[model samples]
Target: MSEYYRILGVPENATAEQIKKAYRMLARKYHPDMNPAQDAAENFIRITEAYEILIGERKPPQTKSAPQWSARDIARERAKAYARMRYAEFRRRSDAFDIPMHSLLWPRWVNYFFIVFALFFITDSILPKNTIKCDFRIKHYKYFDACGKVYHLADPHTTVEGQPTGDIVYLRVTPIVGFASSYYIEGDNQNGFLHIQDSPTEYIAAMYVLLVLSVLVLRNKTKKFENKLLIKFGMCIVFVAYLFVYFIWR
Candidate 1:
């Protein structure tokens, strides 16, 4: 006798849950809406039949525990069930094969967060627009803790064009135009790393520290070559962009 399990691609011993899962997956993949194969109608009928036999319908009248099935009937059902199960397993394994191992580490949003923050930070910090004695205020729809509102103070680093040094509230930024590099704010009250006269050594030291930390994080089972290249390249671009913005602001 032909095995209905083979028709639906499920295991003979498949539990109700397993059978249901397999049915749904195949149903979606080979639904009338999706599959236009020559045998699609026949295949659908086979699956429908298997489902009916396995999960028999309930009726108020003329009820039965199980169909009076023979050994041949049971054997055929088991064979069909086993076949569907193997097919489902094959699909699962095939999809698992395509994905690289390391990608499984962080969630998708985590990668997106790093990328977005990186761009925003690098852009805003390098070409700052603040000068000493500049007015800073934070406007808000309504005050949050009855304290400070969202302030738009000049980020101390943005300097006036052709007028630096001897300028009060002297500020300097690195990866200077803001592409790559940390921001430091130096004021009479707030002494940040950004100073009027920053040494090259100071910048290199900071960069090396940050880079090493990042490389360590990337040291996982699935090392994406493209990601590594992007980090290195983005850093260089940030550094150069920083210089451009720094001079432009200066």
Candidate 2:
């Protein structure tokens, strides 16, 4: 009896509130879900048992050989099993959610999609392609028209001492998807390389990578129950805010 009080760090004459406070503090420090120490689980169970006994919710059973299990004991065992299952789920989910590059948890379609997208970008960037030469005219400080296509200069002010009225621009269209190919003006300047505005090859590849990572994070299942609820709440707020800004605030 004295040992139980000591375990909870409460006095024998301690009030119910004091006992509860002590139990809660110890539980938070030792609960298996919060604490990773090997002894935390044991300490948590001990503190819980002590708290129950001190609160008169459970009696100290007499020790004997081959003691029959009570209904309460059965319930406790079931609860422990449930806790273990939840812990395992937490571990598995945490790992899966931490990385987006690859995971077995992803569906077949998702895996295939990632593979196809990765292959396309990799092939596009690596494969050899012929260059097309076209006469170009600088339409604006930022971009130029070439072969019926618009190409944004990397730095118009620095790259162009002056925009040539009829400059020859060469284009290396991507072999696979014609996406993110390089373009350059035939000149002495090294920075005469041109790209599509807001959609450079590097930017396109990076956006796809970001999409992959987002998918990985969204696929996280451990926090699924809470995240789904939160996502719904968050999306509602975002949509409402967008509508307000577009229709009323503006």
Candidate 3:
């Protein structure tokens, strides 16, 4: 007689709960829908037959003319199931040790760090402008801002003309927010200083508003039309920002 308990991977004296649990776990592991093995259908049938017999839902064939399913017919299937269970148990143990495979992409803290970085920049842009004081030096008739970016003298006669090379001049600077790093400089120049600003304040304000709207849309369960609208609006903001930064803001 084929050992039903051995085929289902349960003890001979296993309780009803144990039998059911074993049958279900093995069935899910070998079911044709979940498994792609060539012999998955055969193993699934064997698992079902074992469960039915244990539950008293079906009787084993007893007629001599009926085909008998021997242990040899399912030995390979039993071995495959056992190997898969062992692998699954190993993975579970590894997961318990916090060694999951997905950590290869990035740890949880790294994702949080990037989120905080983005929020910091956004908040900085939204806040009021602040004055930054720094000692400026003339280099090759150009001025280097606090961020080390060089700018033309706008009116060379006002500052750089006849000025000693590498002269250090103190200046108070105000940054123009959301306008691609443009700044207003005022200091010890014969003429008042050069002021550079762009007309992207409206675009910057609209982008921020769209970003907030997209967040709200994602948080709520909305209709399909609203979801599509949010996506389109977000894309438009991104495209406009790209155009302003690439062509106008430089």
Who wins the lDDT comparison?
2
**Stretches of candidate 3 above 4 Å error?**
1-29, 37-39, 55-123, 139-250
Prediction 2 TM-score vs. true: 0.39
Q: Per-candidate RMSD vs. true structure? A: 15.5, 12.0, 11.7
Candidate with the greatest TM-score versus the true structure: 2
Model 3 lDDT, residue 233, Cα: 57
Q: Give stretches of model 2 more than 4 Å off.
A: 1-106, 156-160, 184-199, 204-250
Work out the TM-score per prediction: 0.26, 0.39, 0.37
Cα error of candidate 3 at position 163, Å:
9.6
Candidate 2 lDDT over 13-48, as tens digits, reads 999999999999998998777899998877777787
Query: How big is the positional error of residue 83 in model 1, measured in Å on the Cα after superposition?
Result: 3.2
Question: Tens-digit lDDT track for model 1 on 1-250?
Answer: 1265666677788778887887788777665546888765456545755666666641111114445545455556556655665576688767765444324445444444444445544344445544323222223221111112121122452333311222222222334332212222223343453333232322443344334434443454335655544554554464565455445434
lDDT at 177, model 1 = 37
